[model samples]
Target: MELNSAKPGLLCSLEASQSQRTMYPYVTGTSVVALKYKDGILMAADMGGSYGSTLRYKSVERMKPIGKHCLIGASGEISDFQEVLRYLDELTLNDKMCDDGNSLGPKEIHSYLTRVMYNRRNKFDPLWNSLVLGGVKNGQTYLGMVTMIGVNFEDNHIATGFGNHLARPILRDEWREDLSFEDGVKLLEKCMRVLLYRDRSAVNKLQIANITEEGVTISQPYSLRTFWGFSAFINPTPGAQ
Candidate 1:
């Protein structure tokens, strides 16, 4: 997979500020969380794109299924994530053309993505996104993550960006290897809710994807239920904007 240049107009900088240094992301998404359940893998991400402190885009689809079995959830530059999808789609097509019974699963896709990220980093131009790859094949489930710098790892549960900061602690305390599908979705929803409440780049609307031996299932966009009745939310300091 090759890294593409950031999309024109993807960044929300003033025209006067445009320069080589401005090629990096100015609008970005937040966290993505994925975990393994007894049946397979489940992932979730909010639909938000933030430009600096401004909420820029809504209804952006950050989680998508790759080929038939693998699903990917991405956070960071929305343009970079879209570019990564194009690369992965081509890779999967070539693999399909090989006519081999075996295809790239979650593990293989994760490896390919990490190499792409690392290669781009070596060129001093990274993809500017973090990804969660999840899938199940031959009764084995895989859940892994990779960052812009190419750091990669697998866990029963994994999250990127703010999720790494706010969600992983809850996962560490509550995640289980043999979690049921219901429990897994509940856990992910819990994580997403926390992110929506605490992460400024996060939104209440989210999409969840699941991959089992049967194949991939991506849910329609939805919003999480929230309560903002806390004292701090109800009352701010005098003269506070």
Candidate 2:
């Protein structure tokens, strides 16, 4: 008897075919929180990346300064976010080469990212990230978000991943049109703290990027003050990360 040799060959062929078809995320980040403030825009994200359920890497930066008038924060596959950054670096480099005395602002960067993401989606090999973009252009605060499938929209405030679920409600209630830089930082920290408690992938350390007419200022990585002592934990507490 041949012992059904053809079945094994078929299974191996299917596995190989699937593996060659696309780039899948391995290590990924969790959420990004951002909003427009009185001066410009503030964006925040943690320095952690997860390998599946394991918190695999710390000190992974999820935010970057883009051009002169823009900052970008990402949640989802870490490598995919790096790839997107390379694309933007090229875009900005090309703009600088033109010497037209004009630079790509946040809105332009967001639109370009929309096209890149949509094009990748059509290829069925999307970048696997939800990105938050913010900046100040000629005193206008622009904040927008783009997803892996090319869906994009602008709002006064935005959050991705767990943040969309946990942090946006706080932003809606307390975010103000005249939010000073100090107040904005406090608000973002408050949001991140909530996520750290609820989100399994969230890390204690994070960064906040501030973009304004003057330029961009990304703060050094810092950890938030957290409280883990509560009577609720004795009975299997809520969000005990």
Candidate 3:
């Protein structure tokens, strides 16, 4: 009777393992940064994927154009991120085939992705990524973020992963609504430089994309200028053999 509720070992009862009930990411990217300037939105991400503590992929492209006006950037499981892109690709294709001339905007794409990530989490299987969506539609700029848990918010500027920790502070102090495209890029570079110096998972090679009323343009991968003359970086063992 009450023995059914007893401990498993005493009754020789075999308990099933809950190993597959959750998700754990293997290869993951670090962070993504997005901001809104006068003309439109801008985003940046580095090309690096880490396996545990080991560096795995170095040329991964985390920021991508969605539809015609929006750009999406992700920081997390690289494979899962790619799967999200496939979903968007299909969605965009379907919209094109409909010939409605009404494409999915940044807000719409972000909302759709939020649903996807949340649904997967509810199933005990999550995508393990933080996403940034940016675009310019109807002469208005949009910037938003969604986490693996489906948490989301919009702001003039948004960043994911390490960017949230190390870059947001800088952005909060510097980002402005009417920032020029040149200034926006410089600001993003400042944040990325800090990340490159502080975040071990971050790489120096990065891509910056901007979406104006015209369209989206992602820059070629480039590295930032770094100085290692500081004492902390110069010598860990000043007098040691």
Candidate 4:
């Protein structure tokens, strides 16, 4: 009894769990938008991180390339997203070390992440992020989402967080399987512009990532051009007074 009490295995475990669990996200992002195009998958997200109602950081890059086949965008806690990336880093490193010439693909990465998120939820300590993963493999374009609690699904177009509320409707109205690269970009911009207008947490500065048969290309950070000349913008309730 003394030795077992000295180890304090259960106590140590409880402490570790408490340390890692996030009851709520502190620094968070707003939305992620992605879709399929003629050549590949395109993903976009802004660079802002909000703490409660305050915009705390303005240069957080929430999209990253996974292995050689996936582009991942995340919305929600920035630190949790970074930890998830570290998990992928270890996973990819191990895959390469195998030296079997078989690398992990987009589907595999997505599945692994789904399991990770689910497991974390089962532990009652979720990652507090919504993830959008997109890729092109063997001429097949893939786009999917996994929420913070691990609900996952595939779709022709995907938007997370505020994008799900404000941007997906636009995607549903206009997305197509045969969209050209230029058209796809224009479509994403349209969605993002709406999020910027409606989602107070969203910022104009953002990055776009493209993953294709050739490889992944993440654009340098840039801002979208917006117009505020609409009547509603000039005065929201013109006659309320």
Better of 2 and 3 by TM-score: 2
Q: Under the 3 Å rule for N, CA and C atoms, how many clashes does model 4 have?
A: 0
- Supply candidate 2's per-residue lDDT for 10: 82
lDDT of 1 by residue, 43-101 (tens): 99888889877998898888988987899988888888888999998999999999988
lDDT order, best first, reads 2, 4, 3, 1
Instruction: Kindly provide the TM-score of model 3 when superposed on the true structure, using C-alpha atoms.
Output: 0.87
The clash count for each model shown is 0, 0, 0, 0
Regions of candidate 1 where Cα sits further than 4 Å from its true position: 1-22, 236-241
TM-score of each: 0.87, 0.90, 0.87, 0.90
Better of 1 and 3 by lDDT: 3
Q: 1-241 in candidate 3: lDDT tens per residue? A: 4658878774554433424433678999998988888888889999998998888888999989998889999999988898889999999999899998788888899899899989988887888899899988888788888998899999988888888889999999999888998999999999999999889999899999989988999999999998878776777677653
Q: Candidate 2 has which clashing residue pairs, if any? A: none
Q: State the RMSD for candidate 2.
A: 4.2
lDDT of 4 by residue, 67-102 (tens): 888889999999999999999999999999999978
Q: In model 3, which residue pairs have backbone atoms overlapping below 3 Å?
A: none
Candidate 2, number of clashes: 0
Which candidate model has the greater TM-score, 1 or 2? 2
- lDDT of every predicted structure (CA atoms): 0.88, 0.92, 0.88, 0.90
For residue 213, model 2's alpha carbon misses the true position, in angstroms, by 0.6
Ranking by TM-score: 4, 2, 3, 1
